[model samples]
Target: MDMRLLVGRNVKRIRTARGLTQEELAERSGFSQQYLSDLERGRRNPTIVSLWELAQALGATPVDLITPDDHAD
Candidate 1:
């Protein structure tokens, strides 16, 4: 699977599961909502530090951000 899609799905899944909106997450993560939207659509290639920051904002770990989901296949 494409790593971009994998990470994007993880981000979206986790965010929604936690009842977080893109705007809210953007505010929390210091990223724009548009950026998050692009990311969730697999249009963004995040750096390690960006992933770490996003994970921290989402109350998750960087590993969780990068890990493939069971439904990822």
Candidate 2:
């Protein structure tokens, strides 16, 4: 599977599990809602800094965003 899609799915899963909307996550991550939307859709490649910010915002570690899902195997 593609890394972009993997990260995107993880981001979306974590975000939803935390009960955060895209707008709220964007605000917390200091990014735009459109960017978050693109990210969640696997249409954007986030930089390391962006990933760190997003992980912090979501109360997760950066690795959590890039790790493959348990169901991926």
Candidate 3:
């Protein structure tokens, strides 16, 4: 699987698990809702610092964002 797509999936998974909407995540992450939406759709490439920031917003570690789901091929 593509790394970008993997990260996107992880982001969406965590966000939903935390009961946060894209807009809510955007507010917490200091990123625009559009950006989060694009990211969830696997349309943007994020930097490591960005991953860190996003992870903090989601109350997760950077490794969580990069880790692949077991059910993912």
Candidate 4:
């Protein structure tokens, strides 16, 4: 899978695991709902700052968000 898609899926998984709605994540990340949706759909190219914001909002590290799974490799 594409790296963007991988990251998006990972973000979504973490958000769900944390029991947060998209709206809540967006609010905590200081991002728009549309933007968060786009990111989750892998339709937006997230900047480093955006990634950092997402990680912070999800209580995760950037490494966790972007790490490639061994199964994928």
Q: What C-alpha RMSD separates each model from the true structure?
A: 1.1, 1.3, 1.1, 1.7
**Tens-digit lDDT track of model 1 for 1-73:** 7778888999999999999999999999999999999999999999999999999999999999889788677
Better of 3 and 4 by lDDT: 3
Order the candidates by lDDT, highest first. Answer: 3, 1, 2, 4
List clash counts for every candidate, in order: 0, 0, 0, 0
The digit string of per-residue lDDT tens for model 3 on 4-51 reads 888999999999999999999999999999999999888989999999
How do the residues 1-73 of candidate 2 rate in per-residue lDDT, one tens digit apiece?
A: 6777888899999999999999999889899999999998889888899899999999999999999897454
By TM-score, the better pick of 2 and 3 is: 3
Q: Which residue pairs in candidate 3 have backbone atoms (N, alpha carbon, C) closer than 3 angstroms, thus clashing?
A: none
How far is 67's C-alpha from truth in model 3 (Å)? 0.3
Cα error, residue 28 of model 4, in Å, equals: 0.4
TM-score for each predicted model, relative to the true structure: 0.93, 0.92, 0.93, 0.88
Winner on lDDT (1 vs 4): 1
Q: Give the TM-score of candidate 3.
A: 0.93
- Per-residue CA lDDT of model 4 for 1-73, tens digit only, reads 5767778888888999999998999889898889888887878888788788889999999888888865344
